[model samples]
Every structure is written in C-alpha cells, then in structure tokens.
Target: MASLNVGNLGEYLREQRRSAQLSLRQLADAAGVSNPYLSQIERGLRKPSAEVLQQVAKALRISAETLYVRAGILDEKERDELETRAVILADPSINERQKQVLLQIYESFRKENDFETLSHADADVDADVDGSGSDARPKQSPPSS
Candidate 1:
C-alpha cells in the first residue's frame, strides 16, 4: 500500500511549540495528548485528526486555520481565497505598498508549501532599531546606492 503524505502538520506543531518555549511534555499536557504520541506525530510517524489538531492548536495559542493549513486540509486555492478575503477585510485605507507586500508574502507561502522543509527566509521578520527611538518595523528601506 502506498503511504499518504499528510503534509507537515506535526512538524508545524512541533516548531510552534518550540518557538513558544514549550517542552514536549508541557505541550502534551496542555494539549491532552501523550508525550509519546506527540513525539511520534512530530516525527511524522503518526497523523492527527482535525479535532485533535484543533485542540493542539488551541493549546499552542495558534489559530485552528493554521493547523488546518498545515494538515493539508486547506489547499493552495483555499488558502488563496482566504488571503483574498483577509485582505478585503482589512481597512480600505491600506496603501498600495502594503498590498504589494501582502501579495508577495502570499505568493511565497503558496510556492513553498512543502511539509518537510522550512519556508524561505523571506518569511522571517527582521528587527531594526532606529536612533529616533521608534519601535522596530519591517525593514522596508531600499538599499543604499
């Protein structure tokens, strides 16, 4: 029998948990799952159901839609639809630059939907400190000539 690739739900969960500084045991306890089960899931040896994924996402303080996306329940088309809806739901006053950035991000996400591999470094947000004491925002300045 052919094995099914359920996408990277487990790895996504594991990364999110680690990013949140939570241990496997801690995540398992909070998600009402066993450490071994969680470990297997993280290792891609087991697949979790939607309900379980939802519970785990809730425990990790992430949106269930994120979990669904990781689980391959939301395909590229659906994700694009959601992104379009989200952009529409945002303030109409948003500038063209903001829309361009959002489109770039969405395209990058769609192109790098691999489960086993991490997305490109473009997904990372750089923190820059200005001498003017403003909070760090996304690095949008053009490179010096």
Candidate 2:
C-alpha cells in the first residue's frame, strides 16, 4: 500500500458509526465483536482483519472497500474502485441505505466481470503481471532536454 493517513481512520470509523445511529455496543454486537475491541478499533489502537472489516461494513450497511481504503489495505485495482465509491458517497442525495444498495449492485457487476475474465482468460495472451517482456504497451522514452 502507498502512503496513507492511517491514524484518521478511527475518526472516520467513529463518524460512520454515528451516522448509522448505532451505539458502540450496538455496532460491536452487530459486527459480532466485543465492545472493547470495537472501541479499540475506533480509537485506532488496533487494525481489523479483512474478515472483521467485512463484518463491520455489513453491520454499518456500507462497503467493505471503504474500510479497506481507510485502513490502507487496498491494492491498485481496488484503489481505483475506491475512487468511484468516494464519488458515490460524496453525492449528497443518497442516504446510507441507498449508498449500500448502489454499492452492492456495483460490486456485483464488478464481481461478475472479474469472474468472467478469470474464467475466460485467453490462453494465447501471455503477458507478465509486471508488464515485462514481449508485451506491446507503449513505454516512456528518455526525455530530451
């Protein structure tokens, strides 16, 4: 992960929990975690695993990717997707539940596309993940002064 303001994630989490109108104990119960643990998470004293984050997102009726982005756990691909989610959340018209529904639909489509791509990977396409070798994408040339 790149550089991120990881400390502010607790404030963000606290704000989200409050926005959802859930008490600390309530969210902890909903996320199937202990109250003190959830409190610690909100205080930035601990980092939750992906599974726990997913559970918290479900309890908050929000995207797990949001939590992942906040915690600086996303890869380049997910970071790109996070930009879209941020746009959606920034829109003042949609409420939290609406945002959740939209995110769910969007995520389903992405998952479907990912499944299709993986299932139908071209046997002839032998590009390395690091963009090395015979692949033909344009490369930056040395700048002439």
Candidate 3:
C-alpha cells in the first residue's frame, strides 16, 4: 500500500465536489456514504477505503485513478500506464491478436524504461473470444436546413 496522503486527498475531493456544484449531502447521497462520513473525509479527519473512494469518484464523474493516486493508492506513473493499457484493450477497432501484439510492444517499451510491466489480466476488459471486432457507430444524417 502506498503512504496515505489524507490531507491532499481531502482537499482534492473538496475541490472536485465544489467544482461539480454538489453539496456535501448531495455528494454523500450520490456516493452512498453518510453525510458526516463524507464530511470527515473532506476535512481530512478520516481515511476512506478504496471502495468509498471509488464511489466518490463515480459520484463526481471523474477518473477514479486520479483519486487513487491522490489518496496514495496508486503511483502516478502506474495510473498513466494503466489508463493507456485500458484504452488499448478497449479499442474495438483492433482484433484480439492485434491488441495483444500492441500490448506486447507497449510493455516492452515500458520495460526498457525500467517500469514495472503489468500483465493483461490486470486490466478490466471483456475478452473478444468470438474473434470479431466492431467499432460500430450509428449513422448520422445531415439536418435539413
């Protein structure tokens, strides 16, 4: 576990809530936490677990990894690489083999830079077991003037 930076995390959460124009109660309700608990978290008087942090991130409609990094749950570099890998894996335009090949190349680059390489299993991706990839989009017709 990374060292907890409760103060920084609290301040960041406060700022994000304010930026989203949500009150403490609103955020708490949305995050499925008690109002006082959320308040304590924001005031740096309590350390929230990752689950709570994830709920708060969802309520804020922001990246959960950002909150994780601020709360010392993940390193900044790890978050960056994780996000990149997630994007690569989620791209429906690429086939499973192509995605795996791209990940191998990406991991190699990271390894060359002395970064810890993450396995494919570390990402939350739906496997394309059918061997078919789709990047389907609804066709949009031009508006008539």
Q: Where's the lowest-lDDT run of ten residues in candidate 1?
A: 120-129
lDDT of each: 0.73, 0.83, 0.86
Error of 1 at 96 (Å): 26
Q: Among all windows of ten consecutive residues in candidate 2, which has the lowest summed lDDT?
A: 122-131
* Residue pairs in candidate 3 whose N, alpha carbon or C atoms collide under 3 angstroms: none
Model 1 Cα shift for residue 49 (angstroms): 0.5
lDDT of 3: 0.86
Candidate 2 lDDT at 38 equals 85
**Candidate 1 steric clashes:** 0
- How high is the lDDT of residue 142 in model 2? 100
lDDT of 2 by residue, 37-121 (tens): 8887887788888889889989999888878878878865887788888988888998999998999999999999998897656
| TM-score (C-alpha) between model 1 and the true structure | 0.51
Which candidate, 1 or 3, would have the higher lDDT against the true structure?
3
Which segments of model 3 are wrong by more than 4 Å? 1-4, 115-145
Q: Ranking by lDDT, best first?
A: 3, 2, 1
